[model samples]
Target: RGFVVFHAKFAENYRLYSRSHFVKGIELMILLIVYEIFGQPYRSPVAYILITVSMWFMVGTWLFAPFLFNPSGFEWQKIVDDWTDWNKWISNRGGIGVPPEKSWESWWEEEQEHLRYSG
Candidate 1:
């Protein structure tokens, strides 16, 4: 029998060459700024929810969607348009607050709830 089974270096090189990188760190930075302004949950619940939803969609569209699914003959109109539309930064300036109970149980429960509804 002929041997032709081992090609680890070539395979790794090819895989690394084909990694998806549609969205870069700069785009995420812009989105982070947007989130800081309109998405701060402590400032306004509605605005926070809106920003969260928008950022979620942006992440899905730019980060995971392009690589995972390739729609037939599909193209994008603009790069990271989902997060770039916000023109104002209110800068309400709020810091992260500790959750009630100061323990991991409540956090786990919240994560479980999110997973249950998210899926």
Candidate 2:
């Protein structure tokens, strides 16, 4: 049935959306879920309804609820290709490398240089 195909596609999209780090992905997944579940007739008489429903259940429990309730901001790609263990890897890989204590050193130098030109 046409509805069944749509449901299958929705499930696939939902899976990707839940796992994706980008905001658009999550939004797409939520939209698909609403289309299939919330926007529909009370129940489908089709026999395959159970199958797609199970797919939705699996995707929801494994992905959607977890992402919605306790989302992690960390990108998955960074950890996937990592060669070392968590302890060895630098958690601040994307941030400035300068240490907090020495940050004022660079800030002071830049400020002094700016004052020299203005004065």
Candidate 3:
């Protein structure tokens, strides 16, 4: 009776484990083996579809959906405010704007001098 119960318990655990992981693991292993066997010249349509689907899922769910999923995790409102301040500061500079190639330190000095002289 004790031996029978022990065997039954082991079998039950084995069955549960097999059900949870064995089928998926075996399928993945078989797929890898098949992929290795199939030379590059003969491509699998299913594999291409799977790869395309995965790429679409990743880009659509994460990259493009910024409001839903921010890749940088920056607040949208803060970003908008920063853009607004940058535009305001840039536009306020007189028609003769700072040259693009100048370093920030040099540009700042020139901007300060201009403001002081113009004021």
Clashes of each: 0, 0, 0
Ranking by TM-score: 1, 3, 2
Error of 1 at 39 (Å): 7.1
For candidate 3, write residues 69-99 as lDDT tens digits: 3223355665565455445444544335554
**Candidate 3 backbone collisions, by pair:** none
Report lDDT per candidate.
0.41, 0.42, 0.44
lDDT of 2 by residue, 58-104 (tens): 54555544334432313364333322332222332322565422333
lDDT at residue 50 of model 2 (Cα atoms)? 61
Measured with C-alpha atoms, the lDDT of residue 36 in candidate 3 is: 54
Say which candidate scores most in TM-score.
Answer: 1
Candidate 1 lDDT over 52-97, as tens digits, reads 6766566555555443443321334322331232111111222245
Worst 10 residues of 3 by lDDT: 5-14
Superposition-based RMSD of candidate 3 using all C-alpha atoms, in angstroms: 24.8
TM-score of 2: 0.24
Model 3 misplaced stretches (Cα beyond 4 Å): 1-10, 39-119
